[model samples]
Target chain A: MPGDDGLRSRFPISFRFLDRSRTVAPPGWSRWLVPPAALSVHLAIGQAYAWSVFKPPLESALGLSGTASALPFQLGIVMLGLSAAFGGTLVERNGPRWAMFVSMTCFSSGFLLSALGVATRQYWLVVLGYGFVGGIGLGIGYISPVSTLIKWFPDRPGMATGIAIMGFGGGALIASPWSAAMLESFGAGAGGIATTFLVHGVIYALFMSMGVLLVRVPPDGWLPRGWTPARAAVRPLVTTADVSARNAIRTPQFWCLWVVLCCNVTAGIGILEKAAPMIRDFFAGTATPVAAGAAAGFVALLSLANMTGRIVWSSTSDLIGRKNVYRLYLGAGALLYLAIALAGDASKPLFIVAALGILSFYGGGFATVPAYLKDLFGTYQVGAIHGRLLTAWSTAGVLGPLIVNAVADAQEAAGRSGPALYTTSLYIMIALLVGGFTANELIRPVHPRFHEPAAGAPAAGRPLTTEGRQS
Target chain B: MTTEDPAATGPHPTGETTGETTGRTAGGGRAVLMAVGWTWVGVPFAYGVWELVRKVAQLFAG
Candidate 1:
């Protein structure tokens, strides 16, 4: 079933084993197994956040600037969006088994190749390895579990996705300290970096295998026990109609959600990119000012907020509709920014609450958006659609830092001190959130004309096979 | 909800095949297996939270 085309066609030998291994779940087999399967892959790839841990060492050992050292991580994120967007159709047709295998190979090899590069002192090899090769892994791996999890927990798509995505945020927490420890012991040289990269590659390949083995598509008519399509449809703005990935991109709703995601991510990332420095600056004029170490702690607390929000807020979305939850994310996020901006360094507790609240909503935005896609577009090709939507993240990643850093730098040039430095950026974030809120309000059900025809229409919870894939 | 894959095609990575078709209360060995699976995800999160809490405590400790 897996090795039908694309990479599967090229690697028929491996696909043969993987395809048979990833059987659709037999009836009455537990659906609960699916989340862990998804988490296994996400937790491993989520280590991308800890790429910064490699930065200081890489710059020192390789003799490069901060911008040059950041190139591979930046390129990795770029390729992540591109590969997922382009390869989504193949992923849908080939199924999660094939997708996971490709992710594992590319992601693991990226590290191994980086290991070789570090050993050889070739910066380009490191770029090609982690940036080009590993990025594709991030994209494929990120989306691989998404559709499967939604299928399993149709009753709670937001919560199902939250569980997996929370691992992505948590991944950095595990890796940042772990990689720091490794570099400390191994001496942060080219050999040490290579060792770290090699270990990451090997361990991730083994770890992600758990996802490949554990993930399953539902049988053609499977639904959770005591949950039916009718019960799920009672929520507003959700539809039973399916839109193929190709056709989905043609609709206005797709683009609107893209804008919504871009704005929300840009706002949150604007704050996150400058978390340590921003907190320190905000309290610099206060009596009990924040030290550099304390600022790092604030960043850690933001990470916690990010991960906690992914689970807590997204689960809350299951109770309230997807639209309403976004209303809170974008709407309340603006208010939080206002509080942070107007209050300045007047109070420590207010600054902490405002920042933490904003970070939580940022995490909530990522975890909530997929479920929203499921609601608007149906589960058909949702992974693919979600893949395309990740371009929003790439855009925000670049835009967020550019805006925050540029404004902060400009303020510093004018000899501005303290919270005034972030003032303009905070207001810009508020504008971004408000823009995102407006876009979310505009999202509506896809027009039925785009729906797949009756005879060949995919039943809810069934995998969408490409026409050529239907053996 | 469509095809009912039979038990003969048993045991992928999760060794629990459909052959031992226990009643559908979502219990027995499967529940234990579920606990193990959930814990696989939750344990790291617990550690991460513990680490963050320690960091957060520093803001007040000073």
Candidate 2:
């Protein structure tokens, strides 16, 4: 058949195994296996969050300024957005195994390069290696499994995606302590840092290989045992039709979602980036001042909430519908931010609860988006659409920290302390969340003009689903 | 076409019990692979969660 044989003709024998046709799951090959494959990559790449574990050590050991030390992570975020936006289409064309392989190579090799840079004290090389190279791995690894999981678990795309994405949230949880221990063992000097990076590169490469070896695309038209398209079609936003990633971008629905994601992420990340100091500052003037260790614990709590939210809220979206869940995220999220801004240290428990709520919404926003894309655009190139959407994350990554840190720095310069330090930033987050809530409200069903023509219909816009393209 | 070729057969008939039970009926080897796959990812994830939980405990203790 052309599906299998055509790929063989295009690629050399050695590389042909990476083709889409090569990864098709065999009959009755359980779809459950795909999530673990995806998790392996996500868990490995998620180490990006633990970049801070190395930041202090990098600064002290290399005698660099704090801002200089942050360059590698900042560059990596930019690369992640850039690569995901640009490489998304290529990823769709290549399939999951190929993308995972590329991700594993770039991510691990990026770490190795950082090790080389650190060992030689060439900081630019570290930025290039970890930020530029590893960032590409992050972007590709992120979206690699999204479309496949949606395809495999059409019955539970939200939960399926949440399973993989929760790994991303949880990745740092594993890396932070592990990296700290490694740094402790090796000492925090240049030699130790280089060795730590080298070990991370090697270990992550081996761990990510599991994803490459195990990932398989569901066979065309493969549905879960009892589910049918009609069941899904009952939801107004859920479409039985497919839309190309190209056409999806042109639609207002995509842009609305872009704004929604950007705002939601900005709000959540502002607090997350400032969690430790923010909490301490909030209670600084109170009778019960938060200690340094307690602040670290608070940061850990937010991470837990972020990881847990990915799974719980996303799975809830399966029952309540994506729109309603996002309504809760944006609507209720804005209120929580407002609560923090106004209440401040008046109630410590309230402050912690509200911040955790916002963090959970942040993680949920990341996890639930691919499934939301599937609902709006169909599964044809949902991963690519998701890839495109993640530019919003990159934008918010910069915007969130800039808003909080800039404001806090200014407040401190003005001699402000306690809750006053972050009040302006908290209010800004509330406004952003309200904006996100408006954007979420504006989201409507995507116009059918963008939908790919059904098989055997007039070849109007683009090819139909992945199944149609493959056949 | 190969027996595994899904395009050849198209969508399975609705109400067919082909997914979960098929894995069970595939016998011990496939089940063993499933166990190994989940454990490989699960163990590290569990450890991370445990470590974080310990850290979070310091918050209440403080």
Residue range with the least summed lDDT across 10 consecutive positions in model 2 chain A? A1-10
Tens digits of per-residue lDDT for model 2 on A241-276?
788788888889999999999999999989998899
Kindly report the interface RMSD of candidate 1, rounded to 1 decimal. Answer: 7.1
Alpha carbon lDDT of residue B42, candidate 1?
A: 75
Alpha-carbon TM-score of each model against the true structure: 0.91, 0.93
Q: In model 1, which runs have C-alpha deviations exceeding 4 angstroms?
A: A1-14, A456-471, B1-36
Clashes of each: 5, 0
What are the per-residue Cα lDDT tens digits for candidate 1 across B1-62? Answer: 22223232333334454444464443465567677777876776576567678887776665
- Top candidate, metric TM-score: 2
Q: Clashing residue pairs, candidate 2? A: none
Top candidate by lDDT: 2
Clashes of 2: 0
